[model samples]
Target: MGSRNSDRIPIQMRRRKCETVADMAAQGWDVLSKCQACGLVMRVNLKMIAKVSGPATSLWNRKQRCRRVGCTGFIEFQGRAPDMHWHETLAAPSDGEM
Candidate 1:
């Protein structure tokens, strides 16, 4: 039984890999937005970009609210930046953790 389960593990892993590849293919370039006030950038992964936009927008809105008495117009859109490969490297799961 243990050997049988072990054999199934590779099959399961292959399925997961195929699913991830399909998801990656379905998602093209991601659209990102930035807040001018705090220079906070929100990266929207295209797979579920629309679903996540509200939270990202809310974060920017909350950041715009000034606790200080003299501040006004705290939030503005700064625009997008080119996606960086370093981010992918950082996001990859470490072998040790796996």
Candidate 2:
């Protein structure tokens, strides 16, 4: 009935949820939008969004249309952390370029 990792707190409880645009901005997160039809991926303009809409705007479950020429598509959004691509000094040469 004894376990070494039993006392450790769960990762879910330790992690903070970034719900709103303000929360994402405060935590250094970028909102990435991918086009459904054209398959183009681009970072969303959070500052412009916040100004036009509100800082409390939620990215999920929103029906956003893509503004690309000659393409009728929707945008799928996702959040990305700043350090996701790996920090400069920590990457190994064996890993190669991404």
Best by lDDT: 2
Q: What is the C-alpha lDDT of each candidate?
A: 0.32, 0.59
Clashes of each: 0, 0
lDDT of 2 by residue, 8-98 (tens): 5332221245456777677786677877799887877887777788998867545478878887898777665554442111112323223
Span of 10 residues, lowest total lDDT, candidate 1: 84-93
lDDT of 1 by residue, 1-98 (tens): 33343323322232232223224324342334444455445554544533544322221112244334454434432211122222121122224232
Q: Give the TM-scores of the predictions, in the order they appear.
A: 0.25, 0.62
Error of 2 at 25 (Å): 0.6
**Cα distance off (Å), candidate 2, residue 8:** 16
Superposition TM-score, candidate 1 onto the true structure: 0.25
- Output the lDDT of residue 6, model 1: 33
